[model samples]
Target: MTSSLLFASEGFGLNLNVFETNIINLAVVIFGLYKFLPNFLGGMLERRRSAILSDLKDAEDRLDEASTALSQAKEELSSAEQKATKIRNDGKTRAEAIRLETEKRTVEEMARIKQGAASDLNAEASRVTAQLRREAARLAIEKALATLPAKLDERAQTNFLNQSIKNMSKD
Candidate 1:
């Protein structure tokens, strides 16, 4: 390695210190990077990290808001379902009431019609009975007159009228 590293002296260089030269080059590069690169790159990295963190915070806040909104929507949906059930029950109740009322009305109307028909029938029967009675009384009076006239003189007529008066008084 020593022989490989040794070189023939050129015209102006007989002595060479490679280790010191390498160390000096390394120092210069290190100092140059330290002086300029840390300030610029570190500042850029910090700014980038801050922007990323801010975006993450905003996203987290948006996620929370969205979850809250979703919860509220679910609650509203549940309430709406309950309201729909109540409305359905109310409608059923109203329909039942209407049916009952209609049935009651139908029954009342039937009763009224039956009563009116019965009244009409009774009136018609009473009128027929009265007419038959009047006809029967007229026939009886004619038969009595036809049978009584063969023996009826004025004296007999007077005696018959007196007997009729006496029977009526006894009754």
Candidate 2:
């Protein structure tokens, strides 16, 4: 609206001419800021971008190191597993060998026992045979003594006694 004035209507009041004065001043301020603002804001944005890139680089390096550590750990685990398997196999083989050795010893011991038993049986049989021979000789001598008095005269007895004494002296 026309306030019937060419300048401000009051002391230090706003210039309300939208098309004539305010638009022109606002356009000049916007143009001046646009020219200078990029130099200041661009440096700040560039610094922030550099910081973010540096962080990403450090993260990538850390990831690579972690992957290397993981691979090394896997290798160590595999080596340990192989060693365990070797130890287990060795234990089983040793057990089998020990069992076989024990069996051999047992077999040998049994054989020795059988041999000793046979020897003892042979010795017992020989001793019994000797005893039977002595018993038979004593019985035969008694039978001869009982029949001697009826069968022989006094002179025959005297002659037999002399012969027995001669045989005993020679032995």
Candidate 3:
């Protein structure tokens, strides 16, 4: 192994000189990168931060608009419910009024019919009474005519006839 190391050192000898290793070039490049990198990266980072802020502002505005719209919708629904309740109450009142009116009319009509029927019955009774009186008067007259000849002689009948004629002339 020592022999191999000696052969390697003779074939490719190590240089101790700094200029031959290019150390100054590496240091200059490192220094330039350190001085320039922050300016470029700072500008990019500032632009990204402003863009994120703008997006956050837009999101907040949209949320406010959505909240306002939801409140308005709730108010409209409440108003509609009130209107529906009012209409239902009015309908119930109207129906009750109609039913009461119908009942009143029915009672009035029944009273009128009953009165009419009673009036008709009274008129029939009065007519029948008058007819019975006429019939009784006719029967009495016929019976007197049939018995008149047996009760009166010819001379008496002649005298009664003369008396009836005199009474009619006086009236």
Candidate 4:
């Protein structure tokens, strides 16, 4: 081993006097890195894990809030739909009632008009019949007054009077 170390030292043209010191310096630097690096890296990794957990908790809370709001919105939407349906049904019922009332009024008005027309017709027919009777009686009276003096002479009037007296005695 001493011969190989001499040959290695001779190959690199380095003297054996500094080799042990260089190895000792390298060993010190390696030991220092091994001792401090794990603590620093472990502290950084732990901080990162805590930050990730906090972010996950915040995300979960937001999700819960969103779910609750969605449920409330759904309930409101259903209530609005039900109210709209009820309003529509009420409007239809009111319209139908109005239609029925209008029809009834129209029928009553028609009946009243028909009754008035019939009454007017009956009154006009009665007036016409009365006028005709009065005209016929006037014509009959005029004809009799104009011809009675010429047709009934003294002998005819005496014979008619004697026959009227005989008819009165029989009754």
Candidate 5:
């Protein structure tokens, strides 16, 4: 090619063939970028996409496990509550039975104590009546001895003695 075709005249300086130079520079830059950048950038983007997908799968698995655990915990809590309720009811029934038994025993004891007291009172009354009868008999014998006369004739003494014996026997 002629030098004039390769170099063009310009007001500022000698201008190289502008269209050809621009085309060659663009081609070289495009080839160099394509040669190195596809491996580096492509591999980085692929790794990033793979990591994101794995993270998504792991999150889904964790969510499913959490749901299962929650359901199991709820079932266990329900069972525990049922057991607690049963225990409370059993305790109430046992307490009621014990109360009834205690009341029955108390009533029986009270009746027994009252009967014993009545027996004691009856025995005391009989003892007092016997003592009073004995005291009255002793008083009658003393009165008879004090009132008898000592000076008398044989026939008079015999009659007086017979009357005194009769009075003593009557008492």
Candidate 6:
């Protein structure tokens, strides 16, 4: 009974052969995991890195495009502002020119009107003077005819007729 208890190989005894076999199996599994898992996990990690780098590059390109578009918009805005200023200046210039031309035309028209009025006044004065002279000559002729018959007697009329006939023959 004492020998059976001390040499219990099939129960709780420290069997070196089984222990060595377990150790060998664990070492083989650890070696297999170490050999194959790094390659598989490394391939997955490399693909993930490449995807991240591609996303970063695409973001940078988009940023550059946005910056270029913003610059172009700024330039176009400046150009439009300049054009508006030029248009405003041109409008002012044209308005000034038109105003000056209108003023000149107004002055010329006033001058022409004044000249026409003066000429009309002078013509009216000349017509009135001529009419007055003709009226005075007619009145003088009438007065002389009314007094000539009473002043000249038959002998004086004969002498006047004889003198008028002598003057006509000398011409």
Q: Per-residue alpha-carbon lDDT of model 5 for 60-163, expressed as tens digits? A: 99999999999999999999999999999999999999999999999999999998999889989889998999898888877765654444567887998899
Candidate 1 C-alpha lDDT tens digits along 5-103 = 345444343334656447688888999999999999999999999999999999999999999999999999999999999999999999999999999
Residues 1-171 of candidate 6 have per-residue lDDT tens digits of 333344476566543564544878888899988998899989999999999999999999999999999999999999999999999999999999999999999999999999999999999999999999999999999998799889999999899989999999999
Q: How many residue pairs clash in each candidate?
A: 0, 0, 0, 0, 0, 0
TM-score of each: 0.64, 0.61, 0.57, 0.59, 0.61, 0.62
Q: Please list the Cα RMSD from the true structure of every candidate, rounded to 1 decimal place.
A: 6.7, 6.5, 6.9, 7.7, 7.2, 7.2
Minimum summed lDDT over a 10-residue window in model 3 is located at 1-10
lDDT of 6 at 102: 100
Q: Per the 3 Å backbone cut-off, how many clashing residue pairs does candidate 5 have?
A: 0
Residue-wise C-alpha lDDT for candidate 2, range 14-48, written one tens digit per residue: 55667756788888899878987788889899999
Q: List the candidate numbers ranked by TM-score, top first.
A: 1, 6, 2, 5, 4, 3
**Which wins on TM-score, candidate 2 or candidate 3?**
2
TM value for model 3 = 0.57
Which 10 successive residues of model 5 have the least lDDT summed?
A: 6-15
**Per-residue lDDT tens digits of candidate 3, residues 39-130?**
88888998898999999999999999999999999999999999999999999999999999999999999999999999999999999999
Superposed model 5: Cα runs more than 4 Å off = 1-21, 136-171
- Error (Å) of candidate 3 at residue 109 is 1.0
Candidate 4's C-alpha runs over 4 A off are 1-47, 148-171
Q: lDDT of each structure?
A: 0.90, 0.90, 0.88, 0.90, 0.84, 0.91
List candidate 3 stretches off by more than 4 Å: 1-62, 152-171
Query: What lDDT is reached at residue 72 by model 4?
Result: 96
